[model samples]
Target: MSVVSMLTPGISMNSFEATAHVVTQLEVQRVSYMLVGALSSNAYGIPRATKDADIVVSFDSIGVVEFAKSLGVGFKLDRQMRMETITNSIRNIITYTPTNFDIELFRLSQDEHHKERFQRRQRRWLEEIKREAWIPSAEDVVIQKLRWKRRKDLDDAENILAVRAKKLDWDYLNHWTMIHNTNDLLKQLRDECPNLDVLDEE
Candidate 1:
């Protein structure tokens, strides 16, 4: 298990309470969702700045329309993007005007890798916020960051590798990276952050 002492944090998120508040709603609705993106990366890697939260949910029982209502009034949702890449999902965004905290929802897809990652997710208590959160496994988070390949996301990937390389499931990571053709990228990250590969002398 991963456990780090909380000596405050360097991450400056727009709203952690709003993120936790929405997570409570997802739990109440019995929805399967995992926190991804910068907010989540901050937990695994280094704490930095994050504007919004990315939650991938299976909209089988709960939809964005309903989730928006739970977010209270003045929250606008953008149900645009007919079809996106990989997951082939539309952008179902719920923006909380009070804090400008946006929760971008991606409808679960039948993609094999996504399914695996979703199934691999685990819930843990976040002591910093005193709430439980459904977070992607460390390995999956790293892989997704690489797949996204945004400049910030690539940075997140490197940071995560630097911090979590010891705890990460190398077998699982290698399997998916090879499938996604990101094995080279993974190797490069490991090269740059060589300490990530240095397991304790145990």
Candidate 2:
């Protein structure tokens, strides 16, 4: 797992502003997307220090290359589009490196149910001074994270489970886990962290 270091001292611009600029670009481009990952969760009042922004877009033909270029993201496209391509069905993850932060673009799976979940995303204006836009709902975050099924993502889910254990919708999580065939992972989580409550059964 890649353990990206946290921010250091004296960085002029905070990640929130940088992320907002990217969001503004996406908005200007009319891309149908929703913020996710650390930034989104943090924006939702989780308060995690995030160094990058992840925006999950529709898996259809969105012309993301043009969108990225329009934002002046300074990315070099591969002629074959191996690193970033349009033909692939799975969500494409493209990274944009600006000065202080790197933004990730996720082309979410083209599932109507999943897409609807994306539509259900709610933006919360977190903090008066920060004015950070984040998706505050825990159900959505946990659902998406479970779908991702990456090792780090699982760890993040566990951490979130640790924090929001008492409040999580265990029935929903369990149902989704069964649908996604990740009940083993839940079992593993429960095994490793016997004390940390996750599902409603606990």
Candidate 3:
């Protein structure tokens, strides 16, 4: 199934509208990051809402310090600190404001698999006056949410599961989960949300 098959109408317009503006600005400014997390998934029609937009970029080239300083030029940053850069790593959330959306920017890590995912990511959607793209695919999005291990992240994942259930490429989802060592979490989710299995698989 295609990405568009997953989302129903009106489930995520507000968030996308807000995201489009920021991404447009970034592209215009020649910033080199791709949006990830919920917004990314939602763009691919996963149907989930996120409080803020999460982005991953080649911060090694740009450097987190320089990126932070650049962001300060037009944003009111909330918190800025370093965080792991990979699946099991931590990186800082350089959150900012005034775009009516929270922007969480992070540098890509040196992990080979993480780097591969970054390189293979699909463009979020066709051009919309904003040269925007989302990093993690649907399956990866599920895996990351599970890794977070937060109640809210879990809930969000469940929502994605429900909405995208019909269109989910289970084989692909399983592949990424296993690669990321998140099979246990997928099992946990399957056990916790009994209805998940009943979802119409596209």
Please list the residue runs of candidate 2 whose C-alpha ends up more than 4 Å from where it truly belongs after superposition.
1-16, 43-51, 59-62, 73-101, 126-129, 132-136, 187-202
Per-residue lDDT of model 3, residues 1-202, tens digit only: 1221222323343444545544554554566666676666555443544677777766434455554554333344445465663454344554334335566666667665567667667765633323445567666667677767788777667666765665767886777678778777776675565465555344
Ranking of all candidate structures by their lDDT, best first: 1, 3, 2
Between candidates 1 and 2, the one scoring higher on lDDT is 1
Worst 10 residues of 3 by lDDT: 1-10
Off by over 4 Å in 1: 1-14, 127-130, 197-202
**Top model number, TM-score:** 1
lDDT of 3 at 46: 39
Give the alpha carbon lDDT tens digit for every residue of 1-202 in model 2: 1112132222334455545655655555556667777765553323556656666765344576666555443333332322223213334333433454556665655564366567677766545214434353566676666677777666666666666677777887777678767767766764665355433232
Task: Count clashes in each candidate, considering only residues at least 3 apart in sequence or on different chains.
Answer: 0, 2, 8
Model 1, position 38: C-alpha lDDT score: 75
* Per-prediction TM-score to the true structure, in the order listed: 0.84, 0.64, 0.64
